[model samples]
Structures are given as C-alpha cells and as structure tokens.
Target: MLAKRALSIAGGLAVLGWPFAVWLALTYPELHILLPILALCFVLRLCALRGKTGALSRAFKGLALAGAVLCIASIWMREAQLLLWYPVVVNAVMLTLFGSSLFSRMTIVERLARWREGELPPEGVRYTRKVTQIWCFFFLFNGSVSLFTCLAGNIHWWTLWNGMVSYLLMGLLFACEWLVRQRVRRRYE
Candidate 1:
C-alpha cells in the first residue's frame, strides 16, 4: 500500500512537472533522455491505479496510457519533436472527460462539490454545471494554444506558455471560481 501511494505521488509529480522535464530535456540531452523517464512515470501511474474502478479512474488510466504511448513512440522513432504534443494530448483528454460529464447525472464540478458538502440543492447543481461548462471552455482554449506552440517549433515559446503561463491561467480561474462559489453559497443560504 505504501509503495502504491509513493508511486501515485511520483506519477502526480511527473505530470505536474512535465513542462520542467521537457525544458530540461530540451536544454540537456535533446529530449532523448526524458522520454524513457516519462514512459516509466506513466507506467508507474497506471500501476498505482490498479484495483480502482470508476469512470474517473478509467479516464485517468486512459490518460496515463496515452502518455506512455506517446513517450514510447517518441523513443522508438527517435523524434524528440513528438514530445511537444504531450500537452495538447493532455488537454484533449481533459476536455473529453469534462465535456462528457455534462451529459451525465452530475457534472464533474458537481461531483467534486458533493464530496465537500454531502448533497447539493438545485441551485448548487445549476452552479456546478455552469462551472463545468466554463472549465470545458478553458480546456479548449488552453489546448488550442498548446497546439499552436507545438506547431510554431519554438522551444522558448513552448516552454514559456506550457510551463508557466498556462498554469497561471488555470490558477487564476480556480481562484475566481472559488470566490464565485462563496457568493453563490451565501445567496442560496
């Protein structure tokens, strides 16, 4: 159990630090060295998810599998350029997961909100659905920018956008959402 937890942490870090890893790869060994490490991380992540069964778990497993496959292909083909697509792929997977949740009984945001507050009233449900839609739009916009960076073939631009700017944008969005949620909750109360 401890080992699994450790692996899960490692996997999470690998994902969160992906842009830094890519920057290091670009700076040092031309990304050849990083591909194998990324593949290992993805594999470990998948292993950590073993015995978990749910739509969310399945989505995460699929993401790790996709990452592993991308790294493996980059290694096999000896094409470091292929590594640039990982961010785009990540966003695409996220968009799919969040967008699909809209049609389900609960939006992804609603599911998360439920975890914090037992059950949601009608207003909460509507709010979460709107929040989920906002997130879907963010993912779409972010992914488009990521794809643009990849196609531009400029490492500095790619690193800056993917590594720094995107994270800042996401954080800002999250902060804004939290503030809005507070107001919504107060009004509903």
Candidate 2:
C-alpha cells in the first residue's frame, strides 16, 4: 500500500514536471529512449483499468492510449518534443473526471470530504459540487494553455508554465478554496 501511494505521488510529479524532464532529455539525447518506455507503462496501467466503471476511468483509458500512440510516433520520428503531449492528455483526463463528477450522484470533492468527515450536511454537498465544477473549468483552461504552449514553438515558456507556474496556480487555488471552505463551515456552524 505504501509503495502504491509513493508510486502514485511520483507519477503525478513526473507528469507535472514533464517539461523539465523534456528539457533534460533534449540536452542528453540518449535519454530520449526512455520517454516511450514510460509512456508505454502508463498506457498499460490505464488499460488495466478497462473493467472499471465511471466515465472518468474510461476517458483515462482512451487518453492513455492516445499518449502511448504519440509516444511511439515521437520515437519513430526521433522527436523528443512530442513528449509535451503528456501534460495535455493528463489535463484533459482530469477535466473529464472533474466535469463528469458534477453530474454524478457524488462530486469528487464530496467523495474526499466524505472519506474524511463521514456524513455531510446538505450545504456541504452543494459546496463540494461547486468546487468540483470550479476544478473542471480550471482543468479546461489549464489544458488549453498547456496545448498552446506546446504548439507555440517555444520550449522556455512551456517549461515555465508546465513545470512552475501551473503548479503554483493550482496551489493558490487549493489554498484559496480551503480558506473559503473554513469560513463557510464556520458560518454554517
């Protein structure tokens, strides 16, 4: 279990810091070979979830396949830049997960809250749904920015946003949400 959690965190960081990894790989051409292997692993792991329910899981499976295809193409073309698609695909999957949860019986935020707080009040459910919706929009916007950076033909900007700015923005949003949640909880109390 601990290994799983550690791997999960490492995988997430890898995705988030992909642009930097690409930069390093570009500098050392020999590292290019590893990109497709990592992507293939992700594709297999996602494929393993074929039997999982939920639109989000299905979307991930499809996205992972797309990523794997791109990875293979990059390998064939000897284009390390193609690795930029990793974050774009990941953001889209996240967008789908958060967006789909808005219409589900329980939004993602609500599920996390429930795991920690058990039963929640009606207001909490509404709040969680709103938060989930907000995250959906964030992912959509962030994904667009990521795609734009990838296509803009500038590695510096892409690395800056994907490796640093994006995470800082997400952290700010998370911190702001927590502050608002605390105030709202106090008001309800």
Give me the candidate number with maximum TM-score. 1
Tens digits of lDDT, candidate 1, 47-114 = 99988987779888988888888889877887667778889988898899899999999888899889
Worst 10 residues of 1 by lDDT: 23-32
Residue pairs of candidate 2 with colliding backbone atoms: none
Evaluate model 1: give its TM-score. Answer: 0.94
TM-score for each of the candidates = 0.94, 0.79
lDDT of 2: 0.78
Task: Give the true-structure RMSD of model 2.
Answer: 3.1
